[model samples]
Target: MQFSANLGFLWKELSLPDAIRAAKAAGFHAVECHFPYDTPAAEVKAALEETGLKMLGLNTIPGDVAGGEFGLCALPGREVDARAAIDQAVAYAAEIGAGAIHVMAGKAKGVEAQKMFVSKLRYACKQAAPHGITILIEPLNTYDVPGYFMTTSDHAEQIIELVDEPNIKLMFDCYHMQLMQGDLSHAIERLLPKIGHIQFASVPDRGAPDHGEVNYAHIFKVIEGLGYKAPVGAEYKPTGSTEETLDWLKDYL
Candidate 1:
């Protein structure tokens, strides 16, 4: 199975350009990031070209980190801000040749919130379509982000169904799904069509996959059996150094 070092986590110690180089050195065919806005698009593009690695995806900026706002797309009366956020990500993705964008739906509730999320996604999908970039919405466990709007694979599936946009898809993170709902094999079977991207780490403590409660070896087979060709993201916090903890993945690299 192909793997990706989620630069947001694996290479936090390096600069964005250096992180891309590190991922390539670590034997990753591609990479994804949380937020790459701080680094200029030109610089990021140059690094990818030099390393000959694909930047598979990136997340839209979470709104106002200092103010505790996780995302704006689903916030009431934040329509303008949310669309502007989408526009920025779309521009960056286009410039850097990224394949997808993760559209975050932060702290939201009720029917109105869902409606707003759908509206924002509709706009995102439209803007991203011409560039051939997929728009993804992940189900983050509330345990990690207390009020994150999308918190279950079912919830994301439901929202995607409601939006009914071809470009909009699920960013299914196994760690979050295992925490919120543990039936991963079955979940993968049922949601395969909607899954645009997948990520994993150890469950419970969110550490290296090798020490986790989840058996990633079996999970890797499961993913392959399901015909998922995209690189699986290693989105975990290291117990020690990022490179040292990767002994578990040495063979794959």
Candidate 2:
């Protein structure tokens, strides 16, 4: 039940080096990013080295470079695009020494799209395996990502099972699952073995722990009780200053 601050959004206010410094100063042992490719791998590595922070995770395929939307992996008819995206991710991960990569499922069309998506994932996993990196498939909530593929942990679990590789596992985001479904504890208990990574945000508002309905202390307790030692990603928006918002988590730690 270690904590990690997601540097994707909040860290934007600070330079990468300072962001890692701030996260470490704030009592976090590790940090994560959404798309570190936007920054150079050397800079990211340097920052991690300077701040004594572990690179917990980051996205393997972060969609288009220009559009800022639309992922390549889950697109219905884009195997080439998907492979290129995965290759870029593998290179980046190797360069920065990241542990896992969250493989986002792009927009879903129908049955054909899903089949293609699964095929692409299998390929990505094979490509990433040799790099000593694990591929994590996440399920986004439909409300936030309508028609987007991989909206359920059950679906993500099935995909991981189908991939049948030790390096491929589910990135179970508590916020998304709580929104898409309601049973947080049950889902975690059932899927803990298959989950290689975990993320969190307060439900209903996607804000810091205390600002939303989900009781993070209880959740942390459950996670700890289950003996899951992986870092729990703090992927939420701060309602106030990031420092102020994290007061609620101090007790749990």
Give the TM-score of each candidate. 0.98, 0.94
Model 1 deviation from native, Cα RMSD in Å: 0.9
lDDT of 1: 0.90
Candidate 2 per-residue C-alpha lDDT over 186-214 given as tens digits, one digit per residue, 9 for 90 to 100: 88999998988888888898988775778
lDDT of each prediction vs. the true structure? Answer: 0.90, 0.81
List of clashing residue pairs for candidate 2? none
Question: Which prediction has the highest lDDT against the true structure?
Answer: 1
**CA RMSD of all predictions:** 0.9, 1.8
Question: Once superposed on the true structure, which residue ranges of model 1 sit more than 4 Å away at CA?
Answer: none
Model 1 is weakest, by summed lDDT over 10 consecutive residues, at: 244-253
The ten-residue window of minimal lDDT in model 2 covers 61-70
